[model samples]
Target: MNQAVQYKLKMALTINWFCYIGLLVLFAVWNLFLEGGSIPLWCIQTLPLLLVLPGLMQQRYRSYLWLCFILLLYITTGIVDVMMPTRGWQDGAMLVLSLILFFSAMMSSRWHRLQ
Candidate 1:
């Protein structure tokens, strides 16, 4: 990749990772404080993120591609949550974060392919 595209891709990837982590924290906080969720359940919900962390840190295109697919589940969950009267705000937050992550991942993958 040219320097500019490389820089953009790096920035997008960083943002994507940050947003993903933020979403996890949000979910954990929501489950623990708001929903009285069990610790194991919270961990289980967040564990899939760990699977992608190493690859994301390495800026793997394959990882970015897979993340796009995985993020869809989150998006769907967010939508469902938002549709609920009681959980709308929390789910809205999740939806926004997922959208950001999805955009960044898509950009990173696209730029990597162009490189």
Candidate 2:
């Protein structure tokens, strides 16, 4: 790709990550101080996952790898809850979202292919 195109994509990706983070913060405020819905909590809790896009943008393999480990634990806990049905069906939803977040992050990163 040409430098100009690469620069534009990078900018767009950066803006996207910022939007994700900003949304997460908004969700956090909402969940903690306002609505407190399951979806809001989901967004707040998973907000940290937004870091992966920027990490990918910078080609920070170590950060990406770290988030993968974190994602593993998150997914595992969600799966356990799903199997046991501790917090109702939301557990399964959490698990599914975790998987989606991990998948999304990896895919958004292009699995190191973007660089």
Candidate 3:
């Protein structure tokens, strides 16, 4: 990959990592406190993010590649949540963030492969 593309990929990956984590934290907080969601259920819901977090922090290309596939669950959740009347905005945010994360991971993986 070109140096410029590599740099952009790095930035995108970083942003995706942060955004993904942030979205999870935000969701947890919103559900736990605001919506009175169950604690155990919340943990279960966030488990996928936790599972992939180490790889994300390590900046592994293979991890990013896999994460692209794993993130589909989140995308589907976002789509379902977006259909609700009350939390549509938050879900829309998740949908957008998931898309960003997906695109960034895809590009990052491709760029790393090129390297």
Candidate 4:
């Protein structure tokens, strides 16, 4: 790839990794610590994200593609939560993070293909 393409790919990958890990940490803090959810519930919530970790660590384009799909579920959940009467900042934060994660992951995969 040319320098410009490499730079774009690097930036996308950086944003993708940041948002991906941020979402996971957000879920853990939201469900486990703040919400005081059960261990099983927390595990269930994070399992999908966790499943893609190895591939992500390996910087596999497929993982970034799959992550975009998985993020849709979280995005849906975030939307529902934010619409609720008792919604809090965390709900909005989750929605924003998931959206960012989705786009960044998609871009990352596309840029990866260019490499």
Candidate 5:
């Protein structure tokens, strides 16, 4: 890949990593500590994310594609949570993180192909 493409790919991958890890941490904190949710519920929320970790770590385009699909569920949940009458910052954060993660992951996959 050319220098420009490499730079873009690097940036995309950086953003993807940040948002991906941020969402994972947010989910853990929101479900486990902030919401006092059940362990099973937390696992349910995070298991899919965890399942994709190896592929993501390997920088697989397929993993990024799958992550985008998985993120749709999170984005929908975030939207619903934000619309609740008693919505908290966590809801907004979740929505923002998921959206950012979705786009970044998509771009990462695209950039990977260009590489």
Candidate 6:
């Protein structure tokens, strides 16, 4: 295995949580203008795994399962939110998540390749 790959795999956990925290902030943004205040399943499900993908990819078993649980809820929550996000901030939040997800995934994959 390349040292690069090892290094990248190491960072997966951090990236995952960074994304999740970003999502939480996004939710807070939604709170400002939305009338309904229930979180969707997609947000709940995907939020977690996205948080842990870094460690999971590296085979960090301790929190992999926990991440999966979060991912599950995020996925469901995201779907529901998509259908009906009362808060104005939801859309922006999704856009940000999309960008973050794209960048993180790309960078990590490249890092793995370099290793």
| Most accurate candidate by TM-score | 5
Residue 103 of model 2, lDDT score: 57
lDDT of 2 by residue, 1-115 (tens): 5676466546544544554455455445545665435765566466656656567567664655566566787688777877883465555655665665565545444534455
Ranking of all predicted structures according to TM-score, beginning with the best and ending with the worst: 5, 4, 1, 3, 2, 6
Q: How are the candidates ranked when ordered by lDDT, highest leading? A: 5, 4, 1, 3, 2, 6
Better of 3 and 4 by lDDT: 4
- Candidate 5 regions exceeding 4 Å error are none
Clashing pairs in 4: none
TM per candidate: 0.86, 0.48, 0.84, 0.92, 0.94, 0.47
Question: Cα deviation of 24 in candidate 3 (Å)?
Answer: 2.1
Q: Pick the winner on lDDT between candidates 1 and 6.
A: 1
Number of residue pairs clashing in candidate 4, backbone atoms closer than 3 angstroms, sequence gap of 3 or more or interchain = 0
lDDT of 6 by residue, 35-69 (tens): 65445744653455456657755745544445444
On lDDT, the leading prediction is 5
Candidate 6 backbone clash number = 26
Which residues of candidate 1, in runs, are more than 4 Å off?
A: none
Clashes of 3: 0
What lDDT tens digits, residue by residue, belong to model 5 across residues 1-115? 7999899889988988898888878878878887566778878988988888999999999999999999999999999999999899988998998999899899889988886
lDDT of 2: 0.58
Which lDDT value does model 4 have at 111?
Answer: 83
Better of 2 and 4 by TM-score: 4
Which stretches in model 3 have alpha-carbon errors above 4 Å? none
The local distance difference test score of model 3 is 0.79
Better candidate number, 3 or 6, judged by lDDT: 3
